[model samples]
Target chain A: MNRLFGNRTAIAFLVLPGVAIMVFALIVPIGFSFYFSLTDWAGFGAFNPVGAANYKEILTADPVFWRSLVNALILMAVTIFIQNPVAFALAALLAHISQKASQIFRSIFFVPAVLSVVVITKLWVNIFNPTYGILNKLLRLAGLKSLAVSWLSNPHTALGSVIWIIIWQGFGWALLFYYTGLMTVPKEIEEAAVVDGASWPQTYTRIILPYMFPVISSVIVIDVISSLKQMEMIYLSTDGGPGQLTQFIAVYLYQKAFVASQYGYGNALSILFVVVAVGITVLVQRLFRSEGEIQ
Target chain B: MNALTKTPLFDRSAGKRFGKFALYAFLVVFAILQVFPLLWVFDYSIQKTGDLFGPELIKLPLVPVWHNYARAWVDGKILRYFINSSIVVVSSVLISTVVSFCLAYATTRMVWKLRTLAAGFIGLGMVIPIHTTLLPNFIWFNVFGLINTHVGLIIPYIAFTLSFNTLLFAGQLKTLPRSMEESAFLDGARYPKILASVIAPMAAPAIVTVLVMTFLTNWNEFIMANTYLSTDDLRTLPFSIIRFQGQYSSDYAVQFACMTLVALPPLVLYFFFSRWIMSGATAGAVKG
Candidate 1:
C-alpha cells in the first residue's frame, strides 16, 4: 500500500494540476498587481514608475477612500452586532420548535441566500423607487408621506437603505450557521440546565452560548470578511452615490481601476486591499483566540 | 435536547403557551420578510406594466402578461446569457470537482514530501479576496486575448473554487479507513483502480456537495464576468441584468421576468437538493 500510494509519478500527476492552477490564477496575479502598482499604467500606452505615490494618495489624501473604510466599518459592526445576535436568537427558537416547522422555516429563510445577489439588489432597488414602490405606496396608505422618501437616493437614508439590503440578503446564511451549530449541542446539557431550574433563555445565554463559541466566532469571521468584500449590491444599487456615503473598499477599488481607467492606481488600491484584508483577518482571529482562552 | 421545551416543565403555564404563540408569530413574520420579495417579483412578472400606482401590495393579474417572459427570453437576450452562464458554470464546476478530488486524494492519502506545503498554499486561496487579483487578471486576460470569452471566465472560476473544494474533499476523504484499499492491493488491484472504484464511491456525497457549491458560486459570480466579458453575447446571466435594468427601465414587468428567469436555476437546485445543501453547508463550516 505504501509503495503504491507513494508512487512519485502518480502523486505528481494528481497534485500538480490543481497546485499549478492556484499558482497561476492566485499567486501570479498578485505578483503582477505588486509589480504594476508601482508604475503609472493607464491600461495601455507607455507609463513611468511612480512608486508609493498611489498609496500615499489613498492613505493620506483621498476622502472617498476614508469614506469607504468608515462605511465598511459600520457595515461590519451592524452585521456582527445586529444581524448575528438576532439570527442566533431565532436559531435558538427554531431549535425548540417542532422538527417539521424548523425544516420549513430553514428552507424559507435560506431562499435569499441561494438567490443571486443581483436579484436581491435589483429587487430592493425597485422596491425603494419613490414613485411606484410598494414601500412608499404602503407608507402613504398609512398616512406617512414624509417617510416615503427615495430610500436609495436620500442622503439621510441612503447608507441605511444600502446596509439594510446587505443585511437582508446575509441574514439567511447567519441563521443557517447558528441553527446548524445549535443542532450540535448535546441534549443533556440543556436538559440538565432545565432540571437545575434555569429558564430556557437563561440556559441559552449562560451555557449554550459558551458551548457555541467556536461556531459563533466563525460566523462573525465570515460576516467580517464578507462585509469588507461587499461590492455587487452597492455597485448595482447606489454605486456609492448620494455623495459617496455608501462607498465600500471593493467597489471603490473596481471603480478606480476599470471605470476610472487608473490601472496603476487600481493595482495600488488592490495591494492595499490585500494588506488590510490580511491584517483584519489576523486581528479578528487573535481577538477570538484570546476570548476563547477566557472562556 | 429541546424536547425540554415541549415537556410538562416548560409547556405547562398559560404564559409559556402565549410565549410559544408569539414565537410562531415572529417566525411567520420573519419568514414572510424572507420570501415576500421573490413572491412579489413572481406576482409582478405577470401583471401589466404601468400599474405601479395601485394600492394593493400584490395582485394576480386578471389577464397575465405571460408574453413578458417571451420578451425577456428573446428581446432581453436572457436566453443567450443563460446559455452563456451554463457554459461557464458547467465547465468550471466539472473541472473544479475533478481536480479537487484528485488533489484531495494525493494530499491526504499519498506519502510525499511537500504535501503539507502544497496543501497549505492552496488553502490560502480561501481567505484572499478575489479583488486582489482582478486588475492583474484583467491585464493578463487582455494579453492572452481570453477577454470576452467563456474560457476566460471559466478558467478563473475553476481556480477560485479549487481551495475550498479541496479542503472540503480532504476533510471528508480523511475520515475513511484505509483497510479497504489495502485489501484491494492484496487482490492485485492497481492504485488507480482502487481509488476509482473505492474512494470515489465512498466520497460521493461530499463530491456532490462540493459540486453544488461550486456550481452556485460560479453561477452567481458577477464581478469577474462583468469585468472580463464586455460583449453582450458573451456575458453571463447575472451580468445581463445590469443591461436589462437600464434598457428596460420603464418596462418593469419584463425586467421582473428577466430577474425571475435568472434566479430560477439556483432556486430550483436549492430546493431540490436542500438536504445535501444544508448538511453540506454545516459540514463545510465545521470541518473545512
Candidate 2:
C-alpha cells in the first residue's frame, strides 16, 4: 500500500503540469478546430453549425488549394532531385579533404543553414529585384540584360525563384548531414575496396551510398515535411502573389482564415493539410525501411 | 609488399595538391556567392542611397552611417519587439523544460499503465499543425479574454512543441541505467530529489540542446505570434520586421539596418554554440 501511494503521488507530481498544459493548449485546440470546422463561424460574431460544407467546397471548388498543393509537390521534387545530389557530392569532397580545410569550409557552408529565414529571404529578394538590384545590374554589365527580370513578382518565374531560395538556404543542412554521415564511414572498408582494385566512383556508388542510406532517407523525409509546411519564405518574398503562383498550403490556409474571413473553410483546409503531411511522412518512412538495415 | 609499394593513387603529391587547389577555388567561389548578400546588407547599412547603387553598384558604402543602428534600435521599435520576444521565449523555455523534465522522468521510470497512456497521447501531437488549431484557439481565447497577451501566445506555443521535446528528452533519459535511481531510492531519496540532484546534471547537455531548439523555434515563430498579438507592444521581432518594411518602404538602408539588428543576436548566439548546434541538429535527424 505504501509503495503504491508513494509511486502514484510521485507520478502525479511529475506529470500533472505537462498534462495540464498539453490538454488545454494542444489537445483542446485541435478538438476545437474539428468542432469549428463544422460551423459557420466568422471569427468575431455569433455563429451556427453548418457541417461538412466547408470540406466539400474546398475539395470541389477551391482552385487555390489545388494550386498550393501542386506548387508544394513541385518544390519537393526539385529538392529531392537537384539539392540532395549536389549536397551529396559536396559532402564527399569535404570528406576527402584535410582536417583544417574541411573545418573551415564546413563553417562557411553552414552559414546559410544557421542564418534567420527573414535575413535570407530579404537578401535573396534584393538580389533578385528587377530594377536597381545587383543581379540585373551585373547582367546588364555583362551584356546579358535580356535575362534579368523581377524574380519574385513574375508569374512565370516566381514559384521557381522562391523554391530556389528555400533550397539554397537548406542546401547547407543536407550537405552537413551527408558530410557527417560520411565522416562515420569506417576507413577499413575503403582500404579493403582499394585493395580489391575498386575505383573511387565504384566504391562510393556500391559501398558508401548503401552505408549512408539511413541518413539519405532521413534527409528526404525532412525535405518532404518541410516542403509540405513551407510558409515563411513564400510568405516573406511573394505573399502568394502574382495570382497565387507561389502559394503553399500553410500560407494559403492562413490567408483564408485571417484575410478572406472564411474561418470554417480555412479550418477544413488545415485538417486536410495535416492528413496529407502525416500521410506522406508515414509513407516515406515505410518505403525506406532503411532504419532496421542500418547497424 | 611490392604491389603495396607502387605509387599510391591518392598520393600526397603535386597532382593531389593541384586537385586540392581546384577544390579550394570552387569552395571560395561558392562561399562568395553565399556571403555576398550578407556583406551587401552590412555595407548598405552604413551608406546613403546614392552610394547604394551605381554604374558600379558593387562598390563598398562610401560613407558609413552609424546612426542607422541607433535609429533602428530606438525608433524602429526593435527594442520593444526584442523584449516581447524574450518574454515569450524565456517563459516558454522555463515552463517547457520543467514540465517536460518531470513528464519525461515519469514516462521512463514509472511502471504504470497511466504513464503509458499519457506518453502515447502526447505522441499524436508530433504531426498536428498550428493552422489546424489556430481558429479554434482564437475563438476560445476571445471568450476567455486572454487574447493578445504573452500568456496566450506562450500557452499554445509550448503545447504545440511539447511532444517532440518530451520524446527527445525521454529517449535520452531512458538510456541512463535504472540502478542509479534504484540506489537513490534505497538510500531514502524521493523521486523529485533524484531528478533534481542526479538526473538533471548528467542530462545537462541534452537539456541544453532542447533549450536551444525551443529558443530557435520561438524566436523564429511568426504565425501564432502574428495571430495572437494584436497590440504593437506585444509584437515579436518577426512581426516588427514586417511593420519596419511598411514604415521604411524606400529607405533600403534603414530596412537593411532593421534586418541587421534582427539577424545579429541569433547569429552571434549561434556562433558561440556552433558545435552544440551542429551536434544537436545531426543527433535529432539521425535519431529520428
Candidate 3:
C-alpha cells in the first residue's frame, strides 16, 4: 500500500492530464497569440513581422478601440455603482420580508440570469423592433407616441439599450449575491445596534454594510471582469452597430480577426485588452486588500 | 414580540409601515422586470403576430399556436444542433470533471513539493479572459485539422473549465474529514481502492455542483463554438439559434419559438437543480 501510494509515476499520471490541458490549451495559446500579435498574419496566409506597429496604430489611430474601452468602463461603473447599490438595498429589504415571499421573488429575479444570452438578447431585440415591438406599442398606448424609436438601431439609444439588456440579465445574479451575503450577517449585530438606539439606516450604514464588505468587494471585482469581457449580448443584439457605438473590446477583436480578416491586428487588440483586464483586476484586489486592512 | 414591546406604538409606526410597503413594491417591480421579457417571449412564441397587435396591441393569444414549436424544431434544424450541443457539453463536462477531480484530490491531500506552484499556475488561468485565447486556439485547431470538429471545441472547453472546477473541488475537499482516509490506509488499502470507495462517494455533492455549472456554461457558450465550428451540421444550439434567427428574420413567431426551444433545456435543468446551480455560482463568485 505504501509503495503504491508513494509511486511517483502514478502521481504524475493523476496530475498530468489536467496540467497538460491547462498548459497546452490556455498558456501555450496565449503565447501563440503574443507571437501572432507581432507579425502581419492575414489569419490564413503568409506573414510579415511588424514590430509594435499594430500596437501603435491601435493606441493613436483607432477610435473604435478607444470607444470600446470607454463602453466597457461605462458598463463596469454602471454594474458597480448602479447595480450593486440597488441589489444591496433590495437584498436588505428582502431580508426583512416573509420567507415565502422572499423565496418567490428570488426565483423570479433569477429567471433572466438562468436563461441563455441568445434568448435574452433576441427577446429584447424583438421588443425593441420598430414595427411590431411591444415597447413602442406600450408607449403609444400610454399616449407617449413621440418617444417611440428603433431602440437598437438608433445611434443615440443603441449603446444605452444594449447596456440595459446586459444589466437586466445580470441584475438577478447581483441580487442573489447580495441576498446571500446579507443572510450571513448575524442577528446579534443588528440587535446590538438596536439596543444602542441606532436607527435602521444607521445600523445598516455603520454595522451591516461593513460586515458585508468582503462580499461587496468580491462582487464588484466580478462585475469589473465580466463587464470587460462583455461579448455575447453585444454580439447577438447590436454586433456593435449604429456605427460602432455599441462596440465592446471582445466583439471588436472578434470582428477584426474573423470578419475583417485582420488577425494580427486582432491579436494586438487582444493582448492590450488582456493587459488592461489584468491591471484593473490587480488594482481592484489591491484596493480591497488595503481597505480590508484599514478596517 | 418581546423586542416589539420595547418600542412605542405611536412612534413612527405608520411611516415604517409605508416604508416596508415601498420596499416590497420595489422588489415586486424588479422581479416583474426581470421575468416579464421571458414571459413575453413565451407569449410571442405561441401566438401569431396579427393576434398580438390590434386595438389593444398587447393582448395574449386567444389560441395557442403549438405548431410554431414543431415548425421551429423541424425547419430550423434545432434537433441536430441539440445533438451537437449534447455531444460537446457531455464530453467536455465528463473529461473536465474527472481531470479536475484527480488534480484537486492530489493538490489537496498529497504532499508534493511542486503542488503550490502547480496550484498557482492553474489559478492564474482564471485571470486570462477567453477572448485572449480565441485567435491562437483557432489557428492551432485549424493547423491540426480539428477546426469544425466537435473535438476541436471540446478541447478548449476542458482547458478553460479545469482551473475553476479544480478550485471548487479543492475547496470542497478541504472540508472532508481526513480520518476516514487515514483509517482506510491503516487497513492497507491502496490509493486507487481508497479513492474509489471512500473519496468518490463523499465528493458526490461537489461533483454534482461542478457538473451543473460546467453543463450550464458549455451549453450556453457562444464565441468558441461559433468560431471553431462553421458547418451547419456541426454548430451547437446557440450558433444554430443565431443562424435560425438570421434565416427566419421575417418569421418572428418561429424565431421566438426557436429561442424558446434553445433556452428551454437549460432553464428546465436550472429549475430542477437551481439549488446546486445557485450555490455553485455564488461560491465560485466569492472564492474565485
Highest-lDDT candidate: 1
What's model 3's lDDT at B109? 75
DockQ score of the complex predicted as candidate 2? 0.49
Q: Give chain A TM for each model in order.
A: 0.97, 0.93, 0.95
Say which candidate scores most in TM-score: 1
Model 3 alpha-carbon drift over 4 Å, by segment: A1-7, B1-22, B52-55
lDDT of 2 by residue, A132-156 (tens): 6788888888898778878888888
lDDT of 1 at B15: 71
Candidate 2 chain B, run of 10 with poorest lDDT: B124-133
Q: Which of candidates 1 and 2 is the stronger one according to DockQ? A: 1
Candidate 3, TM-score of its B chain: 0.90
- Per-residue error at A170 for model 3, in Å? 0.9
Best by DockQ: 1
The sequence of per-residue lDDT tens digits that candidate 3 reaches over residues B36-145 is 88788888889885655555666687789988899898877898989999999999999999999988888887767788988887776677899888888888777789
Instruction: List pairs with backbone clashes in candidate 3.
Output: none
lDDT (10s digit) by residue, model 1, range A93-175:
99989999999999999899888888999889988999878889889889999999999999999999999999999998899
Task: Provide the lowest-lDDT 10-residue window in model 1 chain A.
Answer: A1-10
Which is better, 1 or 3, measured by TM-score?
Answer: 1
Q: Rank the candidates by lDDT, best first.
A: 1, 3, 2
Q: Per-residue alpha-carbon lDDT of model 2 for B1-112, expressed as tens digits? A: 6885576666678577888789989888877876778888888888775566667868776567877878777767988999999999999977887788888888876767
